[model samples]
Target: MSAAAFIRITRPHNAVVAGLTALIGYLIATGTLTPPSLLLAVIVALITAGGNVINDVCDVDIDRINRPDRPIPAGEISLGGARAYAAALFIAGIAIAALTPPLCLAIAVINSSILVAYAVRLKRIPVLGNGAVAYLTASVFLFGGAFAGIEGLVRNLSLAAITFLATIARELLKDAEDVDGDAAGGARTLPMIVGVQRTGIFAFACACGAVVVSLLPSGDWWGLLYLAGIAVVDLVILFGAFRGLRCTTPGCVRESGATSILRMGMFAALAVFAIAAVI
Candidate 1:
């Protein structure tokens, strides 16, 4: 396989972000940066990349219709080859998790299974598919926390909740964006059920939910600095929501800008979380 094919299939950018996410959890739960934590974070990132590859494999036909430039549809990577690569990555990631601790091992096995199931079948369900993706995104926090012996779990859980809701919002927007491809591929997504404009409204509401979740607990855990940083995060989310509200029905066919804003906001929120822990 060509290096470009492997890179395209893995979506290295997302894998890097996944690594950073695990690193944040490790730092939060461990109370000190450690080499082993970093290593485990890398392993988790690889597993995420593997999941991306499998997703591409399953979406080959849909991608050909909606995303013709993708590796599988573009003829840059074979489905069988991608599957084998994903399996190897899953094994490598699980082995590392297994070596860490029991909790880590359990999480790895469950997450890996869920990844496969999501790509193969669950992704065709209506909002349920989005929920599965949100949960998987949230679990990254727990995965890193498990490595730290479960200390400071409350904080990690809080972060996980924030990530989950935020991810749900983004996933919904994505569903709206891919409605065309989904329809061609026989998916029963929210947009297909309720229409694109309604789906955008739903996505906006979910972002609002994330904002509310972020504000919970008052001053019990976070201080003014955290609140201040979260304000910026909330603003970013609000912008995306506003755009969703303003965009016409046809606009829902491609929510690229709104979706990108949500991703940026998530990264900014993570940064806020990391910074506030120290300040």
Candidate 2:
């Protein structure tokens, strides 16, 4: 297998972004950066990479239809190789976490377990699967904040909540996009159960919740810069969510671009949070 295939299988870009989120979390918690913050970023990145790899392994069949170009489906990597890579990454992440604090170690262990579970079984469920991914995304903040103790964790809670809602909305929309592949794989995703139209509405509702929660940290504490940036972020998210309303059928939703728009909003929000933390 090519080295690029291994990297692609891990979805390294997504892992790096998740790493940045953990760094932002630490920055927000302590208002300063430390070696530990960098360590947490690496740990999160490694674990996220591992999770992505394992997910690819578990999703080989689905990927054949939904993502034919993926490493596994494209024959760039074998299932055995992907599984070993995942285990290595997870072990490395947990080992690094052990160097921090007990809290960090605990979160590392728990998140790793959840990631495996999500790939192996949870992803076949409906809303539960969406919720699992949402929680894992939000937990990066918690993992970063663990460096500063309970106070740090508490400070990051609002951010975690906003992220959780937005992630769930995106996950639901993604389910709609993958309905055919998921159905063929015998998976019971939300859109498969309630229809794409209803799933779109649920996604919209979750997006609204995310927008509301995102505003909670504005004003003097986060500064007007954050307020202004978050306003734009919320608008983009809401607009993306509004577009979901037009997706009446599975075929329509698959090509709607609503999910991609929502993902842009998320990346925008991440940038805003990082900039605010630094300034």
Candidate 3:
């Protein structure tokens, strides 16, 4: 494969999201710089990369229709080759986590299973698929804590729940954006079932709810700050959604911009949370 094809298959941009998840775990577990925490970050990134690869392999046909530029769909990489790469990455990720702790290994196994399931079947199941993705997104942070040997899982449950909800909101909105392609592919996403406008509204509500949940006393003022920041971003996204609803064509540029803003805002929040934990 050419260099560009390799990059496309790896989906380097998406790796940031996985790295951020590992960062969350490191912060919650150590609250300070440590070797093990760094290792956990690498492990999480590997796992996330593997998951993305597998997802691409599974969605090659749909991607050929909606995102023909993607590696597998664009014929830059064979589906079989992508599957082999995914399997290797998944095993490597699990091995790395296993070195950290038993709990980390267990979490890794569960995470791998969930990703496989989503790629194989759950991804076509509408809200359930979205929920599963969101749940896994939240689990990244929790899994980080496990790798770091953090005690009292309950202490972080609230934060995890908020993150899960926020991710779910984003996932739903994304589905709404890709409704046309998904419909053609026979995928029953939220927008396919409830219409794009309703899905947009529901996504906005979920984002608002996530912000509210973050405001609850979680003993982390910094986390609250992150939530407040997220709320501001969400408001902007809401306005964009409103515009999309009113416009005849629903500009893809506006929707993409809103999603980018949300992602950046979430990363900012995670950074703040990490800083707060250390201080």
lDDT of each: 0.80, 0.86, 0.70
Which residue pairs show collisions in model 2? none
lDDT of 1 by residue, 1-279 (tens): 588988878889988888777878877665567777876677788899889999998888778987999988888878898999999989988888877878878988898899999999998788888999999898888887778776645567767887888888888777777777667667788878988778878888888888988887632348777888898999998787667656556455354488888888888887777776655
TM-score for each of the candidates: 0.87, 0.88, 0.81
Local error of candidate 1 at residue 230 (angstroms): 1.1
Q: State the lDDT of candidate 2 residue by residue for 1-279, as single tens digits.
A: 999999888888999988988888888777788875799889999999999999999889888987999999999998898899999999999999999889889999999999999999998778988999999988998888788888888777767887898889988988888888777777788888889889999999999999888888532248677889999999999888778767977778767788888888987887777677667
Q: Write model 3 residue lDDT over 1-279, tens digit each, in one string.
A: 566775667676776667667667657655755665777767777778888899998888778877998988778888888899899988998988768778778888999889989989998888889899888888877887776565624445656776777677667767766767666677777676677777767767776776666666664444655566645655654554444443222255245554565555466556556655666
lDDT at 265, model 1: 88
Clash pairs detected, candidate 3:
none
Best of the candidates, lDDT: 2
How do the candidates rank by TM-score, highest first?
2, 1, 3
| Candidate 3 Cα errors over 4 Å, as ranges | 1-7, 66-69, 73-75, 150-155, 220-258
Greater-lDDT candidate between 1 and 2: 2
Q: How far off is residue 120 in model 2, in Å? A: 0.4
